[model samples]
Target: MPSRARLKPRKMPTQQRSKATVEAILAAAAQVFRRHGYAATTTDRIAQRAGVSVGSLYQYFPNKDAILVTLAERHIDAGFALVRLLLREALAETPPLAAMLRRFVLAMIVLHEHEPELHRVLFEEAPLPSHVRRRLRERENELASEVSRLLEAHPEACVRSPDVTAYVIVHTVDSLVHSFVLHPPKDIDADMMTNEAVRMLLRHLTAEGS
Candidate 1:
């Protein structure tokens, strides 16, 4: 018998289609994970929600955790991007430092209010795996660097070093927002809390290099 002829497999889609598939899967996974946390979310469910087969899901994500990590990356990147845009816009408007800080605080508060559920998922529900945490740390460092650059533009400020000051300011604001969402103080009015936080942030940043 003559040797059987072999047919080469068709070439896979270009990188663009692969990216679109990954994005679609991540988006669907986010919806499912949001509705039903990590423990309850399943690969099959993600595939179904994504309008793709299990095999296709695996092509991009080995398992559910991979999808969660992707979502976390996207969310954190988005959050930081929003901060960058807000700061840039405020800078363009040449707002006073105190006013800019107030706007920053309000921006975070509004973000929390705008997507409470997603914020909860990001802050409360989803556990930041080691890899995700590492990425977040890098983002934090970048944010600090950006803040330092921003502060350098304000050379008249009393603060001597922008790097350290930026880190402190970013972390302080993060702590305040996290605390507000987790446990609001009873004695302080919500509006007053935001106001006080903004004031404290400005005072701390502007205080004579103690």
Candidate 2:
């Protein structure tokens, strides 16, 4: 991982044109990273892909690592947005635990399935900055806290420690969903994966003497 200073973008876009340029760079960087793993991607390649000059690219991002950091930040933000939307819907409906867990699991699968290659590069291949990793951990903790609240409210939940259970649930769903979508087995598919994950979670949360 690079130092925070090294991963920082050179400048922030303020004007409409500058913002568009920044967006173009990020989009191009994502494509480049997807096509060629992070190790092979370069600032010049991203500049060419964005149809911008190297000088212009430098004006916004100091280096490819900076661009990667921005991409990672955007990816994290989009993921959180999706999770929050599902959480809001779950809260509104107050569905059965099975249904809720299924929804969460399916949503995660779908999110990863959208661009599995890009996700793999961002999360698995790229060297994420320390701050970005910290942010991810913080977001996961926040999500776990929300899940804990939901578990506490549910009548069927029999877990002794909602906090611990919620943390486990969040990490389990995230890990399994990512693995199933990004590196699926030859025999198992998304539907099967979701069903098994939900079943396991339901049993753990609601089983007798849990």
Whose TM-score is greatest here?
2
TM-score of each: 0.77, 0.95
Q: What are the per-residue Cα lDDT tens digits for candidate 1 across 46-106?
A: 8999899999877656667666666777777887778777777876776677777777777
Find the 10 residues in a row with the least total lDDT in model 2: 106-115
Output the lDDT of residue 161, model 2. Answer: 86
lDDT of 1 at 209: 68
lDDT of each: 0.71, 0.85
Q: Extract clashing residue pairs from model 2.
A: none
Per-model root-mean-square deviation over C-alphas:
8.3, 1.3
Q: Model 1 clash pairs? A: none
Give the per-residue lDDT digits (tens) of candidate 2, residues 1-210. 567887888888899999999999999999999999999999999999999999999998888999988888878778866886787688788888889888778777766776689899989998887788898898888778878877877879898888998899989899988887888899997788888898898988888444
